[model samples]
Target: PFDSYRDAASTAPGTLPSPAAVGDLLGEAGVGSDDTIVAYDDTHGVFAARFVLTALAYGHEDVKLLDGDFSSWRQEYETTDEVPPVEPTDYVINTLADDAPIVDREAVEAAIDSGGTTLLDTRNEEEYEQRHLPGAIRLDWMELVDEETRGVKSGDAVETLLADRGIPTDRETPMILYCNTSRRLSHTFVVLRSLGFTDVAVYEGSMTEWLDADGATEAAD
Candidate 1:
């Protein structure tokens, strides 16, 4: 189910999953529209951020990510591998949220052309050195994470990191983020949003769609 958010029917790489796909998963889990959805994972909430952001974009109003992940939970309480049964509902998303932080290839291209948005590449050094979208400053998402707990760093810590990288902290500065399939960028998206960034967007198609469309790229030595 890790890839449940991907559009299986689409031939396009990095396609966003349909609302029905998301709804079906939530429906089977008996998730209600108004229910508070909390997400967490062992991978430092990087994976959890994907679900949190996706659910929010699909108009689930109260999605949240646990500050600490399963590792932190297991140390404090009992663990469970048991799956609980629940009544399913006909969950459906009527519309995407107006403030959904998603952008398409065209939008990324336009941003690149206009130089109006700060573009961040969330891939690691190897992938970035190979190829990356034009004008993208390499920002490994883990840079904003705490090495000890593998959790997101404090806001002040994040601010310092951003400032060191020369990234703008202005709330109105338009920013676009991307990784191979947006999985990595999801974490960055949430962190930036928490810092009160209002105009942040994720290139859901990410590098996959960019490569498919022959989008121009830059490389580092």
Candidate 2:
């Protein structure tokens, strides 16, 4: 779902499959609030991040991403096409708006207007060079990840990466991260949260929505 666009449902690309459409996908597959889930994607954490956020939103507290994702797992283990046996659970979610680290376009705009956020452009250098939101500091999402393994680098390495970029790591100075969309940004969001950043948010609508709304952008020199 790269370069995804919004639909009538306000979801990226298409609407989420209805509860009936999947027909007990969660219940039959045995997903529950107490489950510690591990999500992964072929392309970095692009797709996995969404599942991580969704799981957390439903009050599933221990969601994690497969570092380097499926690729990394392949290096350490064998493949299996056969599905694992699912232990069903009667878990009912209390969809309370959000339990994930997400923010909308309006909140991002307000943060920018108030100069209250250290905005990080988590897209590639090429994208950032083409055009980026005003005041966004470029930091490619992959920089914090191990190229071969696709796994995120250590916390010490992450701290150094941010420090080198002059990105604030303090609790008070809020930070907002974004990419062309937000998949890449979501990876960084998780890493930061793990590092004890409590005031971080991701602009899920990101550059796509920002540009759609005629938001201001600037190109690299």
Candidate 3:
């Protein structure tokens, strides 16, 4: 279901969908603009966070995330793969949120040029070895997730982990997170925000767009 939702919501690979598309997505799901949205996924809430971030970008204020994931839910309750029928509504997009925590290619380039923002690469080691943005810190998004719970680690634990990597923990520290498609990076965005990282942002058009636009990259050492 999420796979279908994602495909329908996206305009292009590694890009956020238009606000109108998001409105349609919610409407088709029988969700209203002001309704409470609880998002979850099978993959340790990565895709759920992606949806939550997308909703937030469109000024949806009541979005919530399920702790853990569908597997976690199954462990506690009965499970079913049945798709429920729904009546679509007219969910209209009024206005996009101001100063949304998302960055484009040009903004990412400017951040790099300014040498002020921390660029974090949330991909696997093999992917990093193949190619990554110059000066991007390598931190697999899984590193912040608890394997047992399949949820984000505690805020204190995240702080310690980030400090171990020489990353700033101050709320004002500017950090830009990215993965190949920006989906995995959304989980990291939520985790960092929970720790009061006010200036953190996701590069929605991440490595995919970067490579397409001829942005330079470096292989791992």
Candidate 4:
């Protein structure tokens, strides 16, 4: 009801907690592996993505990203501006890499060095210009939600967007998305998936951890 993860979740809205804290939160909430945990955000899916990855890392299964997210929902649906009671349910913990869809800094560096993946940054132009991962492509997710374009274009439109950025939409091309964190990337992930991009995944820690790493390299366009 607060419409803010920070207000409701007792943590920074777009930040990931320690692994132990993640486990404790899920356990205390009685979430089970089979439970459907839907995470979303008002802006890009970055916050939702971080939450998803944390859930997965903490061994929670059946997690999903809410399409269009809170902004789109508010535009299309009437929402109450009050906090609602949460019903705790038992969720089983099940961590599976293939199903979870996450990568670390080392994996990201290796992917870039080996030309094994395309890194997509969903942050805004200013953020992208400030600093970014080496060999990363900037594709602001907010632009895709344009009112004129209606929040998602056809497959052809997606193709055009990728082509303009010199990116191929081939299924075999591994695409890894990131932002300050994964919240915005989550929405981007859903959009890419809807546009028929199958090999898309997200980097969990993103630029925050990347910049903090002892020997991380940055493209800094």
TM-score of each: 0.94, 0.83, 0.89, 0.70
Against the true structure, whose TM-score is highest?
Answer: 1
Q: How many clashing pairs per prediction, in order?
A: 0, 2, 0, 13
Candidate rank order under lDDT: 1, 3, 2, 4
Tens-digit per-residue lDDT, 44-64, candidate 4: 455575566566545565787
Best by lDDT: 1
Question: What is the per-residue lDDT of model 3 for residues 1-221, given as tens digits with 9 covering 90 to 100?
Answer: 44433434454465766667788889999998678999998999988989888888888889877879999888888988899999999988765689678889899999988898999999988998899998898888899989998878888888888889788888999999999887888888887776778998999879978988899999988
Clashing residue pairs in candidate 1 (N, C-alpha, C atoms within 3 angstroms) = none
- Candidate 1 residue lDDT tens string, 1-221: 56887676666545668887889989999998888888999988888899888898898879888876899778788999998989998898766788888999899999999997999998898899999988788889988788777778899998887888788888899999999987899889988888899899999889888888889999986
- Stretches of candidate 1 off by over 4 Å are none
Query: For candidate 2, lDDT tens digit of each residue in 31-114?
Result: 775667887888888677765654554456788877777877888899899989889767664442355566778998898889
Range of the 10 consecutive residues with the lowest summed lDDT in candidate 2: 14-23
lDDT of 1 at 164: 85
Poorly placed runs, candidate 4 (over 4 Å): 1-32, 35-41, 44-64, 69-87, 94-98, 148-150, 214-221
* Runs off by more than 4 Å, candidate 2: 1-25, 87-91, 97-99
lDDT (CA) per prediction: 0.86, 0.73, 0.84, 0.67
